[model samples]
Target: MTPPTRPDIIQWIKRAWASLTTATILGGFKKARILEAGQAEHELSHSEPDWKALICLLQQGNVPVQTIDSSKDIKQDDAVEEDDEVVNGVFD
Candidate 1:
C-alpha cells in the first residue's frame, strides 16, 4: 500500500488531538512506540513511519491549533472519533 499523504497525516493528527485528551495522546504514543518496535523486531513488510516525529511536527506548528474550552459541555459523539484507529494501528 502507498504511504499516506502529508494532508492525510495532518488530518489524522488533528482528529486525534481533538478527539483525545493529552493523557490519552501520551498513552497512544506509548502504544505506538510499542507497536513500531514490534514491527521492527519481526521485519514486518511495512515501513515504520516516525510517529513521534509526526507529533513533533504538530507541536512545531505545521498544523493550525485550536483552543477548546473545558468549561463548556461538548457532545459525546463530537468529542471522539467513532473508531480509535491510528494509521495501520500505529503509523501507516
Candidate 2:
C-alpha cells in the first residue's frame, strides 16, 4: 500500500479501535523486535500517512533506532507474495 493519507490515517486509527494507536502499534513493534524502526513518519500508506499516529505507537516500546525501511522489512518476513498480495494465513 502506498501509504494511507492523513485523513485515512485518522480513520484507520479509529477503525483500529485502539485507545492509543501509537502505543499499540509500537507495542507490536517491540514485540516484533524491530531494532531500527525507520522514520516512523513513512506511514503504512503513501498518500494520507498517519506518521504522527505511528510515532505514538513506536514510542510505547524501546525499539532500536535503526530505521527499518518498510520495503526491506516485508522482504525479511519469509513469506510468499502472490500477485503482490500476501496470502492470508501464510504464517500458519
lDDT of 1 by residue, 1-92 (tens): 24455577778976655665544544564565523323323221223444565456466544565675545645554454545556755622
* Candidate 2 lDDT score at position 42: 39
Q: Which stretches of candidate 1 lie over 4 Å from their true place?
A: 22-92
Worst window of 10 by summed lDDT in candidate 2: 39-48
Winner by TM-score: 1
Candidate 1 has what TM-score?
Answer: 0.25
- Report lDDT (CA) for all predictions: 0.50, 0.52
Across 1-92, the per-residue lDDT of candidate 2 in tens digits comes to 34444577667767655444545665566568652456343335433447565565557555345654556533433545344644594433
Give the C-alpha lDDT of model 1: 0.50
- Give candidate 2's root-mean-square deviation (CA, Å): 12.8
